[model samples]
Target: MVGTAARVTVAACIAFYLCRYGLDAAVMALYATFTVVALGVLARIPGSGRQRAVTTLWVLPAGTALVVLGTLLAVRTWAAVLGMLVIGFLVAYAGSAGPRIAGAAPGMQLLYILPCFPPYAPGTLDQRVYGFVLGAVLLAAAQVLILPEPVTPPFRALLADAAEAAAALADHHDGPAPERTLARARTAADRLRPSRVPPADLPASPTRAHKAMAHAAETVRTLLAQLAALHGAAAPRGGYHAETVGLLDGIAAALRQAARALRAGRRPGAEPSVAALQAGLDPVRTRRAVAALERLGVDDRLVFLRRRALVVQAADSAVVLVLATRLLLGDRGVGADRAGHAFAYARTPAWVLWWRRLSTHFTPRSVIFQNACRFALGLAAARAVAGVLDLSHGFWVLLATLTLTRTTSLETRWVVRQALIGTLIGAAAAGVLLALVEERTTVYALVLPVVMLAAFTLGPLRGPAWAQGGFTLVVATLFAQVAPVTWQLAPTRFADVLTGSVIGLACGLLAWPRGAGSELRRSMAGVCTAVADAVGRTASRVVEPSAGPADGAGIVALNRALVLAEESLAQYQSEPREETARQPDWPAVLAAGAHARRGERLLPGRPGRIGDGPVGGWLRREAGRTAEGYRALAERLRTGGPDGPRGAPTDPDAPQLLNIHGLLEVVPPPPPDTDTDRAAAAALLVDAVVWLDTLTADLRRIHGEMAEMARRAEPPGPRLA
Candidate 1:
């Protein structure tokens, strides 16, 4: 619907333009009108209002301050200086935030507004000269009145995340049991998504929700992992593992089904399999869970079901707020149809998603600091060019300025190279577009969507850089030819854009940066260290599930490790050096990681790290038979396989375990204090010492690079709220 609406709207708009104005004129008007509409939409977003107000308040003064400072510093006044400041502010802001932040969304919207501003505009009256400002305010008010409460994708996403988290937690405590843990986990995840209308649209309690949700998630993960082990072991179908996996297959079903059931205002005749699935991990969680079930006034099953329903409601509401914000702000006004198609494609692209997920490991703050210095250099370039150049049609340069993609010098230099190629092609294409501009303004209208499509097709699928060159041409051509002859304007515009990109790009390359390899290597060490810690900790008496810092897999902690491993592999693969330094191949890493995770998950009880004291020792014993699990993981990470069996360690007695606890602490007296006793103690101590030393050595070797990166990089930019 979004895609169709966008395309049709453009077609209708253009058709209207053609009749109301000459072809050349209508196309310009269309671009102008769309640009205004898009900016109006962006101004409605939450933080953007603050950012805009701040920027509006700051830029003029900042510009003045800089001008004075530079003059005092003996710097020359330059026309391009203002443009450089604009780009700098943008990079700083966008780079500071996560996807949820208002940074990039607003930055992208700048493209729409730029073409309407003085430097780029063709002496046409600023649209705001009319009642456009008042009209926009009125439109905003109407939309707020009409738009339904936000609940949509963000809410669904939140619900899903909460559910997944709960499932993870259940795994850690109760673990999977046919009747209890899975169903309980599902209920926990589902509770946030409600069907009933909320009261007063009250401010949400996000932090509280996050904590509860995190706990539940940990439980669900622990159980599901155990469940997966059972399946891989080819254990029987009706066992806890089978049913647990069934629950995982459609986590949302419990809430989705329950919502319908609730809205129907009648008890469901037979709940979907999800209710059963939600309880899959309960048997091991300590009898407290089961006891809690009995204590509730509702039937045991219904109690769990109702709990999940609440989760669903909360999750749904959060998502609504997020998506509502996006709809209002993510406008660059290329064309509503084109923008819609781009967003649809961008949001759902399978490959892009894989990449985005990979990028999530390195926080946005890190990315900004990583790129800022280089981008600043690019800004300098655009500034110099803007001041010096005089091309008849120069916006292409500005467009070209925005075209380049940046990554570690190793990752995909091709992205940068391709952008350059696209720009060259687009420049050639722009000549044709310009010629047509004289005869038909509709030609520029044709140019706008085609440029967007071309940029989409030729470059990275999303982001500002992709279609910049083409769109630059659209703006440059329409204004230059249609508004009357202008030779100097184009050159200045092109140079201004070019210099900004150059400055930005160079700063990113330098600025005390660290390579991702170093980061990944450190994560590798940390992953090993964590495993060792988990193993060693378990050596002590088993911490009761109900008592202590909780039991089972510190599954969330482990997930973080896995996420790091996954992230490392991506960085490794994405950033292969020009020659030396063996890049860790991601697919290989993923395969190895799978086996390693299986080994950890398989341990009946929570495992501890190697040499993690007595508790770790117990954890090691439970993690897998022998020290083989750790040894196997270490080997596979370096050179080998996902070649291990599941369920091989079931019901093992003492020595059959690797006995990390035994290594860490004195076992019951070995015998009388004769030669035998002395020899035994000495030998054990020596062995323990050797193992500890080796483990630490291995850890440092694996993660040395990552540590170095943290030391070198700038303080991470302010995190987007």
Candidate 2:
């Protein structure tokens, strides 16, 4: 905050001085000063100095375009209002592309708002553009040359650290102290959870590399869970099976190599390919071990089979991590492979990716779309009200609306109340200052920078009230320097802010007032449904390879649903809510979706296939039951019912949905045969069992968490009861 304040103060003061004194241009000076505040304080572009400089440079052209558009539209009130509506929506919606765009969105809106007011000044367009360009250039330079912000660890480095942690956990899966190892593994996994990761560090872009990185993070979490499960499983008397040990060692090495590759920025074509590591730890060995256990007629055959299944599941997760990492490193070969369907955009053109990102949020169901609409309508209404009322400093109305409006009506109300109080206090102080100064331009000039320094430095550190109050004082001193001002200016400023707040509050109530909280539930349900469809489709393909190539549609749907759910969760976390509000365990819900998608991706890619037989028929039935379970879970989420089981079944021995452990215990193994087909079928069945088990565990965890939250949300029963 200190660094940003210092840089903004230096750049803005310099720009203001150059335009005011050197050029004697009041319009240019005003624009130049506000430009610095808009870009520096309002739009907080995150990253190192160089990254922010580059981002600022990119934003300049957009800023210039908005200024030109605003100046042109200022010819009439209706034109400016319409322009505000369209431009506001576009700028806010563009944030769906990436963090950089999202960070610059507020500044872009301010650029348009500044010129689209009563001045009707196409004649001053040149001055506005010049001042904007100057301020932007100066700010960009200041970002790099003036007390640059300290660089934080990069997101890729975080991912690398997670991979290294997972590697360590894998290496000691059978350590003497299982509890300690499991705790460490869980902690490492939690670090990669979306809720735990910083928003600035999230790879949420639609580009291939970002998507791949996100998938790799989720896969690492899955791998850690598998390893933790292995650690907790009762070890055989002679220790882990030879195949399990080999696979664990192989997985550990592969993870270490991945971490090194990430840290070194190695390309996908680098030596010792992660994909090849899968071949070295072949599932064939796992199948042979299962066969040997069955042949020996060991009393602990079922336990050994379960252990082998876990090892296979771990190997599957490792393969996904390998593929995702490869894609992140720009491996087009992986995109061309059959498994690339999971990452369809890995090789897509940039323009197409942008289009997809925008189009995906075009629906009313999307929180981004809802936010854009709310923002646009609020700003448009504020502009229209200011023009109709012929309010002085009309842009202040727009600015108030821009800053005060939040996703939820409840939050907007809270902010509006604080802002109003602050504006009132600031107005009174400004009125006193104006009365005392009485046309002393020098006093105003001297105090301007000090006030600016204090305001910019403390506003954000404080709350919206501080920001509103400090900003009110800033505009007062600024306008006093530009021209003559009286005590009346304070009241005018407060009145404009009040008008904007009213408009913003009205829009908030009329639009999606509940914010992502409600949408998050719907999105989670959508994700569950998509996962169920994908799981059923993948199981079908596994049961019958000739069921045609795996339909990419289900994968795409699941990906889209997961993306939307994640975005909603992010917004929901930011919005204000009552303490007693009933909310699902969002992180757990997200994990369940990720697990389902990962299972779908891994099912068809396993080493073997299953033909229609007793085993295949049983697998199909189990898949149907799993799909039904997810569908039921989705229904429960939507209906706001308890996420956990409602009550014990009338028949305790009846087969339960997602009870893979019980099902596997009773499932008949493939008939004894020396042929490879039987062995392949047995291996495929094991993969299905493990995948189902993992998914079931995730669902149960989500259920338990949700049930707890629901219980907490319930009010105390009547004393009479």
Candidate 3:
């Protein structure tokens, strides 16, 4: 904060002195300093010095175009009004897809207002541009050189925290469930998104450590859950092998290395091996455990070991990939193969792909396209009003309208309230300062540094409303130096802001009406469907690993869906209560996703295709049924119907599941040599059946909870309010 304040103060004062010395173009330079500081400290993107410099360079050309267009339109009253309306709509529409685009909208609107200032001397335009470039460079340099903070620290901390949580899960420490621990990890990871450059890949970006961290955390959580479930459902009645305990310790050791690597931002050193544990499984003991479990018609420990091994393998692979991202070709080391496969279709002919993307926007379902039109319409209306009033600086009205509107009505209303209140407070403060001092220019110069310093400090401390107030005061003071400062100026500015706010609010509520609550529900439903699809696919893999290893695409889709759902939920929670929206059990939904992912990781690329007859058949059938259950749940979420499993829930330990128990515990067992491989395969088949059955039951329960959520009609209390 101190660095930012100092930089802003230095930049603004320099610009002011240049302007006082007859470089009249320094006015824009002053604004540029504010822009650079604001984007550096407040905005999410263009975070690094290089990225910010690039973004600023791009903004110059783009902003210049808007100014030229505005100047052309402003010559004729009708053209100016019409242009404002159109420009307003386009900027608003462009941002309907997400917050990043929405954030850029204000800057676009500011460009439109830039040309509305009094005409400059011939060649003074170049001077202003030069001033802007100079200020931007100085500001960027300050951020890069002054007590620079490392970009990786916060991200490293997030990964380290998640790894510790995973280790705790493996140790069966008493605390939150693995699902809850992972969710917190994911939440933290989200905040760790890289501030500077755009993410290099979709779903999971190899260049983004946070993405890898979040995914690894989920994998660990799932592994722990599988262990817990197997322990609960299949209590091996005999003495446990010390090897099993050692295997768990090995997995825990790998997790510790993962945490250390993430903290150090380097590749992991040689990790503990599970090979010793694998060797310790005496065939005689394994045979007895399998036989005893089969006799009891329960899950087998050997089967659990096989499944656990798969998860450990996946988790270790993920951690290694994250650590390797810093090396040469690091992004491609472990995880890049999957990422490449996911985006291989992008290699299609560029023209064809571009055409398809463009065509998508023309469809009726394209909310972004429709939003753009609505924004234009709203701006037009606001411009017409401003034109009729013919107030001093009528463009301010259009600026307000453009700045106030957001993706949702609720958000627009909130912004309007803040902008209006802020403008009033700022105008009053500026008016007082102008009136109090006998030496206006001297007081203005003295106060400029204080205001610039305060703007940086107060904007973050207070919310957007207070920030807006500071912004208004700065603008009023700057303009007063170039033009006349009068008490009437404050009221006139207030009227302009009021007019724009009303127009923005009206457009938000009435045009193509979509509330945050509705968007939230829709996003949540999408997440449910995504989870269902992953569960179904995983069930297939468990039933028939020989078909192929579980694809990474399913988990990727799950992650993307969850991110969208979380974003929509945040927007919804920030608004007033609405009818037909209920508090969703997000944790339950998240847990279901975790289960699906775990199930996927549990399957091997190659399972024994030749298995014992009846046991294998039953396993396949159970897996199919589990897939069907997940599909049903997905359909229910999409359609919002109550059709779920019609009959009572089946017992996980029922007679059907115990069928393998009878086969293994026969009074006269088959020849020991012949039954060795067959017995192991049969035991694994039984475990698969139990796991699928249990997963399906959990899916059904989540489906029921979602159904109940759908039925909620009354408005709930507003958490954000």
Candidate 4:
């Protein structure tokens, strides 16, 4: 903050002196000074100095265009208000693209608001453009050349660390300290959590590479859980078969290679290790191994199936890791394969990617859309009010509205109260200063830089009140130099702020007043339903591989629903909620969605299909039960019910018809010569079992979390009355 304050002060002083004293252009001077404030204090572009400089350079053209539009619209009251509405929505909605655009949005809005005010300044448009360009160039230069911020760790490095941890955990799944390795792997996975990572470093953008990376991170966590579960299951009489052990070792090696490639900033070469692992675990080889185990008198069918399920699941996760890593390293060719469907956007046009991102948030259910609408409406109303009242310094009204409004009414009200208090105090101080130093432009000029430095430094550290008060003093001093000012200016500033605050408060109440709290529940419910549908569809496809292609619509819905849920969660965290607010386990909800989506992505690609025999029928029944369980949970969430469904079924017979031991007795093993049909069926069954097991475990965990939250939310029994 100190560094930023110094940069802003130096740049603004230079721009002000050049325009005001040297060129004697008051319009240019005012625009230039405010431009520094807008980009420096209002916007918070994050990245290395070079990145920020580039962003600033890109914003200049947009800012110039807005200035021209605002100047043209300033000729009429209605036109200005309309322009505000359109410009506000566009600026705010553009945030869906990424963090850089989002960060620069508020400052860009200011560029327009500054010009769309009284005096119908079309003739001064050139001055405004010059001032904006000069301020932007100077600020960009300062960002790069003066007190630049040190670069933080990149997201890829974090992923690489996680991959290494996963490899270690895989190698030690049955080692002496399996629990310790699992814990360490889990810790590494947690580092990639959305809440832990910086927004700029997150892979949440709309690009295909980012999406693939995000999914890969989620899959890594899933891989760890599978390894732990596999270790917990009873081992075979002679440990895992040689083939199974070899497959596990291959998975570990592939993970290590991926880690190395990511660290070295190179594409993992051709994914031969993954392909080899896949080939080694082919249906024929795996089925022969199972038959060989049966021949060796290893008759614990339950243990046999459970262990195989875990191996197949782990192998699936490894494949996704390789594919995602390749894509992240700019291997666009990976998307050509069926398994790489998740990276569909790898070769998409940039504009289409951005458009998809924006269009996805166009629904009212989206927090981004809600915020954009609320922002646009509030600014438009403020402009209209200012114009009708013919208030002096009317742009201040819009500025106040921009700064004070928040997603939730409660937060907005709190901010407005703080800002009003700060504005009142600062206005009184400004009035006294004006009375004491009348016509002393030199005194105002000397103090402006010091005030700016202090305000920019402390305002963010101290909260909204200090920021508002400091800004009030800043504008007071700045205008005093630009033109003569009296004590009356302070009262006018207060009035304009008050009016804007009222406008902001109204908009907040009228538009999504609860912020994401309500939307979160709705989105979570939608995600749960989508997950349930995807699970059912995926299970069907596994049981019946020819079951038409994958349910693309269902997959897309699940993705969209998860995106909305995540956005809502982000917004909810930022809003002010009541202490007594009862919320579900949000992280668990997100995990459930991710797990379901991962299954949908990987399960259908498994070789072979289960015929409509007893095992296939049993698998379909279990999948139906799992889907029903999720739907029931979704209903509870939608209706705001406290208690969730009971924990997942733990009975041995619950997962299969007549239990695995009984099925083994009834179903004969394949002959020494591998039958392609039997081999395929065996492989599909193993994949299905693992998918269902993992899905149920995740559901059980989420249910337990929800039930715990409900128990806490429940009112105590009359306090021993």
Candidate 5:
């Protein structure tokens, strides 16, 4: 990281010289880059589509660097803020759109890429805007040509892990060692880092690459799903061919790309590549997904042995409500989003909430309202300074302080607290460094490398709050170099930052109005939906003991829902609102989610040890066979060609996993819990329709609450009127 930072310093300087600004400009720009990269890395915490967007939003780093650099160098503020907003919007646009459009795995890129640049740049507001536009373009180009490559790296490691997982299932079923095989596979997968060593040596054709990646995904998914099924036994008979599934599905997506490429008459290598890897299998991350038809446990399935075909047909009723009511509403930003907002609001705190709310309310004059209500106040203040004011940098700095400075997680809050401390320390260090060099050439050289070190150390190191503070200080001191802050201007420059920060807070509050209650309601709804979806998926799909995929898919979805729920709980805790919360049995909602998680194997809970006798052996054999079937399927998928991957001609020894309906069902009373273990196992049983029913109830309840509020606010419903 230090070496990288050193490289960053040099590059920043070159950009500075080429871009022509102050030394402080260079340092601040680098700071933004470091922040963006760090945040992108951190956004991996877990939450909503917007949380993913926030994580992926890259403009913060790039734009911030530009604005700060410009501010110290005498660039106008307006340009800085404008650049920040435009790029911020673009960043948001890209981050949000990417996941909805790109294949699931690649969405991880948002975490890796968004934070590599400044969210706001420094300078004359116009120049800052220009800087931002340039930086955004650079980032876009980098992502198009470079970003996808990194996203694919994690999966390659994942691919290898899947292979090992398959091998583990194989050996376990074959009565050899299971733990050792699984351990090795786990370790191998852990090492795949998209940050440094991405996946290697592939064909030039993106379609081919996509195909390889897709195949890799299928192999991993199927194998992991199967491995999860196998308890521990060595089965002799063959099972579903897994390698074939992974390979074929992977190739299918690649072939789709290939077809497009071939029709376009482009050379394989020369084809205009949208992705570094060909897009692969449709991610069956949904609750009760069809993809898990192979990975359900028979016993687990039997528990939910009644219901089949869980369909979630949500017809966007909110649209009708939106059109009908004069006051339109949609649950676009759920409560999870509200907490996610807190993470972004670290720079300015609850102002994050305000901005989100204000943006929605001022839709008719959204842009104009934002500019006038948010900026005009700040602009008026800027004009007070001089007609030659720099509003752009000020604007974005304010914006980031509003949107990006979040405290959603303890870690996130800690990150900011550390950064602030770092900034203070940095101010002092910079003062010391400034005193020593007296604004000389040697000072410039010395500070440049120091800034680089800060960037690098801040990348991966974690501990006490001091880490961020110290890191921030190091960069701040070096970037707040004295070359620009001559004897006469030093105090004023320092004061400007404080002023900018204050203005930023003020703008954030006024511009984008937000309320906690709405977020809470929305988030609760989402969590319920996610919970129901996960439970439903598990019950419906994970019926076959041998193929048990629904469990894993359910695990992933349930975990996501859990995260949103946890976040909601935290946000609800963070700001206590009397009216918006409680009454709705949060504990029950949480308990339901908890139940979903345990049943899905996403959380830690013992499934009870069999009496260590005949039952144990029988269970072991069953699990082993399950493992074998999963392995067989995985192997078949990885190695199989065009003929539908599995179910091919000439395989006799394979243990068939076809009869699934008998294995699982949704019964009225989940198998009688004779003992504690039985009860816990029963608790793990999925209830697809049950969760959905609960969700519908909750949604209706929330709607009623909203309706009540409306009734109270207006004259009344028909009853009162």
Candidate 6:
């Protein structure tokens, strides 16, 4: 907080000094400096020197161009208003693309809005542009030299630790926690510096290593899930047979080599082959273990338990084998290096992505586009109202409108309430200070920094209202030197802010009002849909081992959707509630997704022989049924209705898991002389049946919750008066 206060104070002093010397376009320097500092603080984008430099370079020219254009348009009120609409739409659309773009949007929008406050000539425009460039340079220097963030060591350590975790999970050792390991990896990746390493060729280059490691982490998590299933109550206390253990050992060794390659920032000269890992676990030896169990007259349940563990181990080994290969080789195949393609491969083309994003605003259903339109219209309306009232420094109203307005009605209301309260308190304090403070320099030098520091520290803690007050105090104090600091104008300024706040709120409510509650439901439904799709895909892969590993891309998508859902739900809970019902069963949705994901991982382990008889048909049928149920649950959640597919929904009350005991009756008790293949088949059938039962139960619970929420839905509240 203190550092931020010092930086702001120093920048303001420099700007004021430049302006005092009658430098041409010096005011532009002051505006640019203040704008850079304010927006940088809001975005939290200056985490690294390179990033700060890049931002400064890009924004300096961008801000200058926008300001110059807005100044030109400001010659006529109608023209300026029209220009504001175009600029607002573009800025908001850019922001909606992603977080990186979102951070820069506010600074760009501010540049466009501020220039319209005062008309400027061509000569003045030239001066302002020059001032903006100088200010940007100074800001970059302050960020890099004054407080240079340390880089390299932390990032390297995080990468190394994540790799170690992946390797350790493959080892199946009790030393490291897989969840904690992956969590650390995620945290590190999130905070990684934007700078890329040199010689970024080949598929899994250092530049793309994080993505590889992340994928590997997810694969390891799946492996752990498999391990959990095998280690459950049905499995024996004794460890896996010699052949299965050997395969795990080979996978462990392969992963260790992959970790080393990641640390060295290169793929290994000779990639570890999954074939070699599979070869270590001889099929004859694994079959012999099953034969031995049958010969010993072991109970069918015991025999089934032993074989289930082996199948799980085999499936887990296969998954780790592929993931370790991916970690070392990257997303592109081994031949990618010879192809001489250096750039990362994206699923969609750049032009197509942009076209889809921009085209959405053309439709009536595009909330973001509508919100942007509303914000622009509201700002224009505020400007008009300020002129009608003949309010002094009416740009203050427009500033408030720009800052306080948001996409949803609830948020806009909250911000307006806070801004009005803060402005009133701040304006009153300014009036009192003006009466006592004779020397303007004292307030500028001393009081300014104090208020700025308070604003920086208390604003976030107390919410938007307190922050607004701090801003008001800073503005009032700074302008006291130029304009008369009278009680009359302070009230007028407060009134301007209130007027802008009202206009912003009206626009939010009137123009395509979508509450946070609806957004949460939508996000939640999307996540549920992704989970259902993943479940179906996993089932398909299980039915055909040749179909390859459960698509890592699907799990990754589910994760991103889950994150969006959680964020939207949090925002929904924060808003004032009209409906008294509890928040939608989000945790239930998450639980169902988790169960579905784990069940999907278990599918890859079905023994090859299990595909032959009635057992095979039963296993496939159960998996298909579970997949269908998930699909129906997804639809129900999405539509907020009980219109799920017509089928026998799993009865949560009467649970029936196809255990080893029941399976023995169906499989003819795999005779004492049964071949190794039959013994393994019986065990795998039991495993599949048990997992299906578990997943079906989870889906049923989710379905029940979805039905309840749908039933409780009230008719839309009375339309806005």
What is the Cα-based TM-score of model 2?
A: 0.91
- The number of residue pairs in model 4 that clash at the backbone is 0
Per model, how many backbone clashes are there?
A: 127, 0, 5, 0, 136, 0
How should the candidates be ordered by lDDT, best one leading? 4, 2, 6, 3, 1, 5
lDDT of 3 by residue, 1-721 (tens): 5555665667556755665545665556544544454344433332344444455454566555665676667666677667766776666554433344455556666555555433423244554455555655665566566543334334445546655654654553232335665565445444344322133111222223434444544544444444444333433345234444444455556666656666666553343222333343234333543544444434432354344333333333333323332221123233333223322222334454344334434433345455566668777777677667666667667667766776578678777887778878987886776667534766666777788778766866775576667766666666666666676666777788788888888988887456444444455566657765665565455445545443465765665566555555555455553343345365566566655554554433323332424544555555555555655544444554212222212334221222344344432342265666555554344345444545655665665555454445325767894
Best first by TM-score, ranked: 2, 4, 6, 3, 1, 5
Give the Cα lDDT of each candidate. Answer: 0.36, 0.78, 0.52, 0.79, 0.35, 0.56
lDDT of 6 at 498: 86
**Global fold similarity of model 5 (TM-score):** 0.39
Q: What is the lDDT of residue 181 in candidate 3?
A: 55
- Which residue window of length 10 is worst by lDDT in model 5? 311-320
Alpha-carbon shift of residue 415 in model 5 (angstroms): 6.5
lDDT (Cα, 0-100) at 118 in candidate 3:
38
What TM-score would every model get versus the actual structure?
0.45, 0.91, 0.68, 0.90, 0.39, 0.71
- List where candidate 1 sits over 4 angstroms from the true fold: 1-97, 100-219, 230-368, 384-399, 410-417, 432-469, 480-482, 486-515, 526-657, 660-721
Please tell me which predicted candidate would have the highest lDDT against the true structure.
4
lDDT of 5 by residue, 1-721 (tens): 3433443344344444434344344433443343333332322322232333333344446445534443443333354334334433333323212222222212222222222133333234444444344333333333333212223333333443444344344333233345666666455434432222232322111222332343233224433333433323232357323432343333323323433432343334422221222121112112222223223454333323222211110001111111111111112222122112211112222443334333332332222222234433443343333224533223223322332232222223433445444445545655666566665655565566556555445645643233433444443443444235433232333344445445444554554333222243344444555555544443333232332442244544544444444444443455433234223444455545554543343211223222323333332333344334323332432343311212221324434432334333322233232444434333223232233333334333433433343344445347663
Compose the digit string of candidate 4's lDDT tens values, residues 342-457. Answer: 55566677687667677889999999999999999999999999999898899999999999999999999999999999889889888888899988988998998898898888
Q: Which runs in model 5 stand beyond 4 Å of their true positions?
A: 14-87, 97-154, 171-178, 182-404, 409-447, 450-485, 503-527, 530-721
RMSD over all Cα atoms, model 3 = 8.1
Best by TM-score: 2
Superposing every Cα of model 6 onto the true structure, what RMSD results?
8.1
lDDT of 6 at 327: 43
Q: Model 6 over residues 153-218: C-alpha lDDT tens digits?
A: 433344444445445444543322356554544453333322232111111211234334433444
Q: After superposition, how far is residue 222 of candidate 4 from its true place, in Å?
A: 2.9
